[model samples]
Target: MRPVVFPHWFHRIRFRCKVCHAELGFKMRAGANQIKMTDIIDGRFCGACHDGETAWSVENCDLCHSGKAGLPPGIFGGHETLGPGRW
Candidate 1:
């Protein structure tokens, strides 16, 4: 399975890890998060908050699963690339 890079900062402010990681029992490893489109459509994973409340809806697959390399655009908003030298 492909890796899904969630917007950590976006979720950090809205909810703690316990809400989805612990409560939903998602693994820390990528490909082990066990999320599915069907589940999300049924209000799981991102669907929990993205149910037209906190962020974009689950129907917008490209919004979260754009299949691009690294974090999606605007995540840092034209800032320098983040790496070992940076934070």
Candidate 2:
């Protein structure tokens, strides 16, 4: 399966950081939470807003899973970086 290319900038424009970090329990950093499909299906994590009411449902796999195969899973298309030679 392709890694989900999460558009953090998109969400940041619509919601505050606390909305997901404090309220929904997502960590400030990527890969900090061990997200599972079962948890989302059970209405946890992304499912909280993506239940087809607040946002699109998980049934749309292409929306999120748009990253190329072999790419690391995490937030994408942002300016946040660890500087040159960090990786």
lDDT of 2 by residue, 24-75 (tens): 8898777788888787888888989989898899898888888889987778
> Model 1, 1-87: lDDT tens per residue?
223556554554566658877876666444455567787778777677678777678657666765456643333221233322456
Name the regions of candidate 2 deviating beyond 4 angstroms.
Answer: 79-87
Off by over 4 Å in 1: 1-4, 69-87
Report the Cα lDDT for candidate 2: 0.80
lDDT of model 2, residue 30: 74
Model 1 per-residue lDDT at 85: 43
In lDDT terms, which candidate is top?
A: 2
Record all residue pairs in model 2 with backbone atoms less than 3 Å apart, i.e. clashing.
none
Error of 1 at 70 (Å): 13
